[model samples]
Target: MAEALLTLAGVHTHIGQYHILQGVDLEVREGELTALLGRNGAGKTTTLRTIMGLWKASQGRLRFEGRDIAALATPEIARAGVAYVPESMAVFSDLTVRENLVLGARQGRLDSARLEWILGFLPALGKFWNHQAGNLSGGQKQMLAIARAIVEPRRLLLVDEPTKGLAPAIVQSLLAAFRELKATGTTILLVEQNVSFVKRLGDRVAVMDDGRIVHAGPMPDFAADRALQMRLLGLAMEAHT
Candidate 1:
């Protein structure tokens, strides 16, 4: 197994007096995809927010590559080579696709070779290069959001619900892009509701409920255990797959 690139130990978070995370613990292995799974309101999003420093961890530790980053600012965390793609597909609606990509470049300049590489995986972005992002379809906007995150190489990607609100064909295309990303040794921590998507792409899986992880194991082991899935997620994985 690859060494862990990110680790959360007994992490807790409170949002405006509501305790959203209750002693959560997780490990994202280097160069591997780890899926964070759960039902609605399961602290899955909160975990991601905490990791990105969008939400402060009220207690516990968050470590990336052996450095403590629990209390760092969001920009500081980004400077440390972590990128986050929120579930809302947070694209600049008024900006052109080209403009959005340019802003996503960390160093105030785009690398031509990297831009070409990203375009190869996400040709939709290329096709709509000059179009306003708001004019694009939901799937296209989602692709643009992802494309922006990867406009430059980074150590880790934290993505939330990449397949949300997309047609099956679009979902398949997005999955293919993610497969290419995985092939490049991009470490990812994905939060997803699609059982089949997680099953297909996740190397390891962690299930969360009520702000804490309820199960952690290999993806296949979790997928194959129908009873366990039902117990944790209140449904069978096979039904979704």
Candidate 2:
């Protein structure tokens, strides 16, 4: 078994007056894709933000590579080799694709080899290299967003809902790119609502609810149990798949 690259122990977070995360306990294994699954209002996004240091954890421990990082700032967390691909798609709409990717290089200089590799998997990024990010289609923009995150090497990627609001074909394209990325053995913690998508890519699974991870196990077992899915996700498995 691969050792956990990232671990959260009783993590709690507050946004304004709302207690978003009651207690989030999760382990992201090194070199494997772990799917963070939950129903709406399950605090999935908050967990990702807390890990990225975008939201300070009111209490608990967040450890990456075996060091305490619960109190680190966002930049420090990022510098520690943790990259976040937010659900908002956070692309600089006015900037060219090249320019946006240039910003993703944490050291202020793009690695040519890494850039070429990302472009090869996400060819749309190469095609729209000089175009304004806002001019690209939704799928293209998503590819660009992911491309930006990988402009440099990262040990762990916290990606939130990359398949949201995308057409089926575009989602498939994104899936292909992700599969190629998975081949590189970058550890990924993904938050997704699409059941089929998760079943296809996730090696391990964690289900979150009310800001806490309620279930954790291998993806195959989780996918095979329809009753478990209906209980945790509140939807019949057969109806969706």
Candidate 3:
């Protein structure tokens, strides 16, 4: 309802000849955390890839900030203010944390004010500023990846599996950071399998299955709808409980 920051209409994507995305449509409102939820191989990652222009859509259009970016290159799209953090936590293994943060500053100008803002949300990153990303633990690497994305003046962030393979305590910390980031007016589109994480951070949720979004609604509504969750995500609340 708020001006759509990102929109995809009838998006179709293919990797080689394997048609992965088939007519997917999604809208991300400005300044909200929109979660893309699905079981494994539901094309959640591919949707993020398509939006970031890593996997060019074979058909359909992707508009960001009221501009058509379906044909732009990945770097061009990133320059347009969309940052992506892949599941791998794509941090520079060879670079020190400070050096990685420096590279993440989009304008090539580091603002102490912005740095302070990010550090406030991720105190662990502040402590590890001098450490190499490769040496950091899984949760630390995830934090660094997200901090790198936020260091820039970004309009939208596409994050894939930010809580993958981390301890529950670390996940809670990351979720708190996400809440802080959302409060700072950052628009986030996240792909996550963790239902609890989705329930906590998502203002809206979209369930992807077989390369398509099959269900979407407010997070509470989705969480309460046990049948939908069981059907789409193959998860039962009772089982998890």
Best by TM-score: 1
Candidate 3: RMSD to truth? 1.3
lDDT of 1 at 169: 94
Taking the tens digit of each residue's C-alpha lDDT, what string does model 1 give over 1-241? 7999999999999999999999999999999999999999999999999999999999999999999999799999998999999999999999999999998997899899988888887889999999999999999999999999999998999999999989999999889999999999999999999989888999999999999998999999999999999999888888987
Give the Cα-based TM-score of candidate 1 against the true structure. 0.98
lDDT of 1 at 194: 95
Candidate 1 lDDT for residue 235: 88
Model 2 per-residue lDDT tens digits across residues 128-229: 889999999888888888998888889999899999999998899888888988999999999999988988899999999999999999999998998999
Which lDDT value does model 3 have at 195?
A: 79
Instruction: Quote the RMSD, in angstroms, for model 2.
Output: 1.1
Clashing pairs in 1: none
Order of all candidates by TM-score, from best down to worst?
1, 2, 3
Better-scoring candidate (TM-score), 2 or 3: 2
